[model samples]
Target: MRTALDVHISEVGPRDGLQSVKATMPTADKCRWIDALAAAGLREIEVGSFVPAKLLPQMADVAAVVRHALTLTVSHPGLRVMALVPNRRGAWAALTAGVHKLTLPVSASEAHSLANVRKTSAQMVEELRSVVALRNEVAPGVPVEVGLSTAFGCTLQGAVAEDDVIRLALACVEAGVDEVGLSDTTGMAHPAQVRRLFTRLRAELGSHAGAAHMHNTRGLGLANCLAAFDAGVRSFDSSLGGLGGCPYAPGASGNVVTEDLVFMFEAMGVSTGIDLQQLFAAREPLKAGLPGEPVYGMTPEAGLPRGWRA
Candidate 1:
């Protein structure tokens, strides 16, 4: 929320990263990692998801973790605690946990939608409307957004049409969501596609256009992000150490790396309001929590440029 920051980065490591991994970080470790991230100046973080404990045991303690994260707002004022909800039940739980924001994943690819959420694309939009209604009744102040997953392409169905992505976004808007972000869930996005789709997204949705959730699956994460920026996107979703991938999307891997992303913008003289040194230090808790887990980042490996300051 800093006025000086040119772009908004929402850290999704806790939810997206942890869920895709084999280990369940202890609740205390999760809190510590989150604290480190907040200290590093990440204003918004998707702390966890609301799903059946049997389905994702890693997120079984999500409610408790959300409460712990809420306490951080005292020190990190303006920090927005966010959660991912797959359905109306999940939305209700997230609202009850006092989350500042709720993001629902509605896949643009019908095959991906059915596989991930057990619902068709149309059914998922209806689900979103129900979630929005619940939010209005109980937590009207909370913002509800949709991450239109597989907007770029899908491994299951392959090459999702652009029209589907735009249609689903407008449908979510009509369902009362505040914003709809395009997600490259399969990491199949290229710079030109990213530019064209995001430009069309901004034109159609206007102020309702949201974050660019690019994956580094094909090594185009940074380039796609730069393209999104060129197309007028100001918000992005990344993970510390590039730790996330879709469980249902086969062959998809790695969320955009936070360290590399902040470094990229800062090196270009774009203010991210995030200190690079502290951001690197934040990776310590992550390593401790998920030991031996590969956390990728060019900036962390090479160190900052000589005499560099952010």
Candidate 2:
């Protein structure tokens, strides 16, 4: 059970943010950015994805990035290094790299699933089962998270049914994933929908219900996050500087800004354990790594509110 004061913010800029853009952040700079984030008290970060370099050139150095993140875990014992794995091969690479957590994206919308991974949602669930079995065989302690992307609404196939989302989540759980999260891959989720779906997710999966991956494309990312938080979601996934988009779903913006999300929690008396100022400072390495890349954040631009402390 999570108290109102506890909120876990997982930074995903290195993997999700970088994968969407054409520019590849230097491996060394990625480690620097991740170190800065951990230093800012961010306990979990999706360091990189274990995908083929030809598929996502930006994540070409995932192995090296994971090694660097592991060193940070040595320094900051609570830090969790996570990576995204698309299939069995990626999962093998992530397990070999010794990531603390691995997230597999399973699109809830069949159209999006076929487009994103060339598999149907059910096929992806079967793939998840294989990945989970591999994890148990190799590293039983490591956790596997399934991000049900396009759960809210899909551009390729609009109006994703809530029942479908729930069914898919159950399949993932039966497949042995440690957690299953909901992702607004297209940023089409409203606050009411976010609350209702998250509540349903909790009712169905209980502690297996995972993070809320919201997008700021429609400007409701933070609102939807707050709704999910109210619905008892403790973990939240965001990208520093709002730097991500979906390759399969066109016009999808970056994730909810990490700086803004942290501020929202810390200001509301929820302890995110993040240093707002240091989080802002972490953006420098991002800029240096991807020159000319657009990094968006309201808190960084407006500065802290008058008389406010985090």
Candidate 3:
């Protein structure tokens, strides 16, 4: 995936974006949105999470959505259908659905971990090990990625130490996850902190270092992403229209906008293998699914610069 594109943009709007909003997008509309995204040249998309319907009604039809997205692989051969799995049970469900990849969110902050998953960081690592065992048995080839949320800092527990983030990442790597990525769960990360953590993560974890998932809450999302790229990150996680936040995370809102991020890279002459105009077009279904919902982005709203070519 990285070889063809200068940077890998893993669109997480379907899974991360819809889960935060109050409105539960209809299943058919979700498929239509995913179809639009794939047609826009997004090679990897997190279709949905496998959590219980009672917990997140927005994702109740995740299995069906994944099935629909899989059909697109026939036309977009490089498209990778992915899902977020909170635990072993969710992982089993995602594996059974034949998803191409799995992402597990593990918080570095103990307070956030307990509230989000009802488990401490250590307990979550153990949980990940169990999930890895299941994946090895049922789907050995499938990659399991862990997103270390709150790696920057936490609203509940202020000042998450840099050592704690690295320690947790190493623990997850030891637990058998294919990759470990840092997330600004509360959007508290600055460029310097982002650069430091990712630099250390790559030095220690090497090839296991993964995508940079930054939030735009403090308006530092793009800057932090640039810092991560400077620190040697090639893969990134973004939401179309800046649609994301953690319901469990109070005061946290907004993910890095896909349109703006692509524009930033393409303008710098770095290829993302995505069409800028087509990406803006994908937002139509998103708005159609959730009428009156406010979507955020500078590039799409401003339109491409005059005489611009991508």
TM-score of each: 0.99, 0.98, 0.99
Best by lDDT: 3
Query: Residues 1-310, candidate 1, lDDT per residue (tens digit)?
Result: 6477899999999999999998999999999999999999999999999999999999999999999999999998999999999999999999999999999999999899989999999999999889989988999999999999999999999999998799889999999999999999999999999999999999999999999999999999999999999999999999999999999999999999999999999889888878889999999999999898999999999999898964
Candidate 1 achieves a global lDDT of 0.95
Question: Scored by CA lDDT, what does every candidate get?
Answer: 0.95, 0.92, 0.96
Q: Of models 1 and 3, which has the larger lDDT?
A: 3
* TM-score for candidate 1, residues paired by index: 0.99
What residue runs in model 1 are displaced by over 4 Å at the alpha carbon? none
Query: Compared with the true structure, what per-residue lDDT tens digits does model 2 show for residues 131-249?
Result: 99999999999999999999999998999999999999999999999999999999999999999999999999998999999999999999999999999999999999999988889
Least accurate 10 contiguous residues by lDDT in model 2: 1-10
Candidate 1 Cα deviation (angstroms), residue 232 = 0.3
